[model samples]
Target: MNEPWNPYDVMPAARSADPAAAGARIDALPVSERWKRRFRLIAKAGGPRLPNLGALTFGERMAVMFSVLGLLFGPLYLLCKGLWRPALAYSLIIVAVGFAALMLGLEMLARGVGYGAAVLCANRACALYYRQRVLGERPWL
Candidate 1:
């Protein structure tokens, strides 16, 4: 052979249809460019930043958000039922099903708005966390 093999010289386009080609393209990109691409993908998925809730791997964000929403509604449900054990049990079920229904409804209502709200909320949460953790600012409510 007239030339030595060079993996870097064999890089492919980022939009290549083949997985191997795409991997090669990413491997050839600079770290900052790679992160930029990652953030773009997250933004496309309705995240405000690279690591927003929408940017979390698939079902993880869903589980976390659903759990929080369920917790928020739990006390109201218990009050509405007025019985201790049954109220707790039914409240749990309602939270589960209600979360599912609400997700579906939001999808049907306007996916853009729903996802935008999720992204905005995630951004605000991230900002608050950073302020509290790094700046030693305590939140009062």
Candidate 2:
């Protein structure tokens, strides 16, 4: 494995007999490319494993940090990506944030926080969903 890292690398694709699962896997597959970089950053921050972020080139660093589709659309984007479970969870989070916004009199702040949380959670949520549906592994985040 001496080859340098490529952001467009195809992840290990898992095939399933179920058509629905197959479709979901299709959506979840691309996430690995993006999330692989993001997860490396997350892992480097004293998580389960700490990898060397300094090794990433400038382009790779940009890939790990910048994404707004998830932030702009939030859970709706998750649903479009065949991640219903995460969408549901994010919806509940929005509801809770709405309640807090009402009580705290900071509607914009609460909504902003909720949307930001979705961006942070989106990749890992996709990783977990892909593992569970495609690999038949228990999905835990």
Highest TM-score among the candidates is held by which one? 2
TM-score of each: 0.21, 0.49
Q: In each prediction, how many residue pairs overlap at the backbone (N, C-alpha, C within less than 3 A)?
A: 0, 0
Off by over 4 Å in 1: 1-110, 139-141
lDDT of 1 by residue, 63-140 (tens): 323323224444333233222333344446545655675778854435444343344333333222222222223322
lDDT of 1 at 92: 61
Best by lDDT: 2
lDDT by residue (tens digit), candidate 2, 85-105 = 667776887788778887889
Per-model CA lDDT versus the true structure: 0.37, 0.52
lDDT computed for candidate 1: 0.37
Candidate 1: residue pairs that collide:
none
Worst 10 residues of 1 by lDDT: 126-135
The positional error of residue 100 in candidate 1, measured at the CA in angstroms, is: 18
RMSD (Cα, Å) for all candidates, in order, is: 19.5, 10.4
